[model samples]
Target: MKQEVNELIDPSKFRDRIDIKGIEKSLLVDMLRKMVLIRKAEEKLSEHVESGKIKCPCHLGIGQEAIGVAVSLVMRKSDRAFGAHRSHSHFLALNENTYSLFAEVLGKYDGCSHGMGGSMHIVDNDNGFKGSVPIVGATIPIATGAGLAAKMDKAGDISISYFGDGACEEGVLHESLNMASIMNLPVLYVCENNLFASHLHIDLRQPSNSTSRFAKAHHINYNTVDGNDVVGMYKLLKSEVESMRSSNTPYYLEAFTYRWKGHVGHRDDIDVGVKRGAQLDSWKKRDPIKRLADSLIYEGVLTESEYQYLNHEIQNKINSDWEKAELASFPENEFLITQVYS
Candidate 1:
């Protein structure tokens, strides 16, 4: 009959404002393009969902694109990565096909899951993306298995699992962390702590706001960084991933961020209820995309005109991909029973 209380961890204490020096201009531009592409793609998906074009439920990662893109930059094709419901950015960051994503969302035959799995169940093996699912902490063990396989095969590949802060509440995540740490599995647990699991904030649910305490419980080496700052995350992940690859050790990264949209759809304020109005507005001021672009322009790495042009190019690409997917065919009735048992 004993109840346990969870303490909230202050993420701002670990915030590191990393200098964006030593990064090439070309790479910076590419990062910007990736973020813009993700934003535009999600925007289009929102429109489609509103129009009844996409039947599947999507957990859009509108404000959390930079974390995936930065990590993807450091990951190799041999490494495996997995995501949860809010994972479009995870798939796209690894350079997954946009048309296939569109097709999948549309339930077309050309979807990444062949029209079988919708938004939450995307897979891209060619790009080292194992898969994404809706179940919280479901992929944690899978990622650990992958890391074990990579170790057994001596493939020099690590497994990365991206999950929400809510997922840390699951018992499986704790077990997976313990196993990875004890066995020295080459897995990186990237927790995208957007501060909410559906409508409830972390303070209301967890005792500690910092999820890294769980990592410490398992003796895992962990780093907490600003999820909005792509440059900082990229640098930190580069080092952490390198260590995992070299020592076959497990690493944990907690990214503090906020989602611009509602939990499952396009509406930003509808499902969020009354308490979120002011909090949401304040978070918007800490916008990742705008901050990064502003920093790049101020640092002379990118011009305002160039930034505008890049946005135009990314928007065009998203529009074109959506159009192509819209015209794509759905899976034939006869093919329904296929790919199930195999």
Candidate 2:
């Protein structure tokens, strides 16, 4: 299947640099760093999963890093962000603490979810990330409820729901969209449309590649974004996010991106059963981190050496964090009885 080729979802279609005109230097650098940190952390997870060090299944968003980073930067810390199964990026984008993630996956007591949730169930409420679950489309309605709560509180904070295109198949998503639209709730629905959801290419499941048609049905504003273009993504989502804050209405953003790693583990997922090898190589060309780094280097915002250094810096941090996470103690047998609530 020729996925995302020569289409609007294609990386060649979007040419704006992360260091584009009128953008702040610091913001660009920060976005780049966050994206790098997320990518490195996920890569480490992938390595461990392949080596059998991590027992928990991890979903790596290696190429789909831009959306989470851009959205995190655009949305305020007070805004509540909820994530779906593949939410390592969503969590790290806000907290940037891989130690918690590493610990959580390792089942250590100091994990973000106290080693109970593992990779799919991490939560960092202090950083505005409420939680992520393995259930598909579970948090859309929860985010909608948070949006309604935000409306009732009059606190000026919005709710963000991050899910993949596959979650669009769920009935609760439509209900959440309708409720948010009709009630004028301030919620931002983020769809990471990576063309393939869980080993099946989207063409087999979705009649039309775009999921924003549902937004039109609900009278909610919608936009399809180049999820790989971090700078462009920021400008587009930031405006919509700001507008949603004032209007108290819902906004839907569908980001077109691809995942370098397979659905579950570290491999391309072909030999394991998925027929994605044909298109996987091409999708790698549109890698989000590389695109942003190239643009930044081209625009002279940072040199190649600096970019390499940034990568090295993040990798070193990940290494240290992973070591610390490994040494952390696991919950004692009695701890389960104490922690489990009625």
Candidate 3:
């Protein structure tokens, strides 16, 4: 089984190289700016969580921002997306309001979930971010259902479910994949193989670290890539999504990346008892943002001064959004039972 999985991904056939020559300078700049904004916003969240200003448990996707940004660039407003606990990047990439995100984390009434859902249960139906939940594989089936609905409606929309590699352990994920494939549902299963479920590494949890094998079992078309390369993700997804749109078929993408922070919270600690050792440091060196920035510079598409200017602009925007969220009022006492169902 491991050999079959290993055969599925050939390193020689997969290239880290990306062509940015035809990509517009302005678009590239915008992508870089969005990435910086995500980074800074998470940084602020970290500060708040650590200072005890934000009481809710937060999952920061500091190192995995590129995956969401790259995927969103090609997605339509009508398409649906679902994410797991570490999902700030996913929401932000879909052009969801950062202020609402901040407010939701602060449990303010102006939040995306109207201050009720806290960090985990964020939703923006207008933005096509159906929702994000804390449960590992819960959203997989939900996304599959969305895809089936899209197919029934004859809509060109696709459903995307983003989850960590750990979510593969859940039996429902495989069942969802099988059903989606059998029905020809228009869903994209994106497994961000960050190699850890909380503190346990992929090697410790499964026989083979690659999650694409499961996709193969379902007879779904799939691809694996270096998750840190935003441009690479864009290139691969552009083709795969186009194919899915035409055929109304399901596909899978296993993105190999790492998270800078631990499983939960802004802290580097995985938990009170677990040790991460030097893995975090090694992952930092493979930072997606830095690598993409370097590639942009190397390709002569972005200069150092231009990059700095973009970073400054993003920081200012993030600070403004944070301030607005901080001042937003909490939900009124009477409103608590208003949105609830009997």
- The top-ranked prediction according to TM-score is 2
Off-target runs (Cα >4 Å) in candidate 2 are 1-6, 10-19, 271-275
> Quick one: ranking by TM-score, best first?
2, 1, 3
> Which one is best on lDDT?
2
The lDDT of each candidate is: 0.85, 0.86, 0.84
TM-score of candidate 3 to 2 decimals: 0.93
| TM-score, per-candidate, Cα-based | 0.93, 0.95, 0.93
Worst 10 residues of 3 by lDDT: 7-16
lDDT of 3 by residue, 1-342 (tens): 472234222223323334565578777766776777788889989988888888998998998888899888889888999998999999988873789899999989999998998889898888789999999999999999999988888878899999988999999999999999999999999999877788887777888879899999999999887787787788889889998988999999998877788778877874532335655666676667777687788888889888888788778887898889989999999888777875
Tens-digit lDDT string for candidate 1 (42-139) = 99999988898888998888988889999999999999999999999999988847888988998888999888898989999999899999998999
Q: List the candidate numbers ranked by lDDT, top first.
A: 2, 1, 3
User: What is residue 80's positional error in candidate 2, in angstroms?
Assistant: 0.5
Candidate 3 Cα misplacement greater than 4 A, ranges? 3-21, 270-275
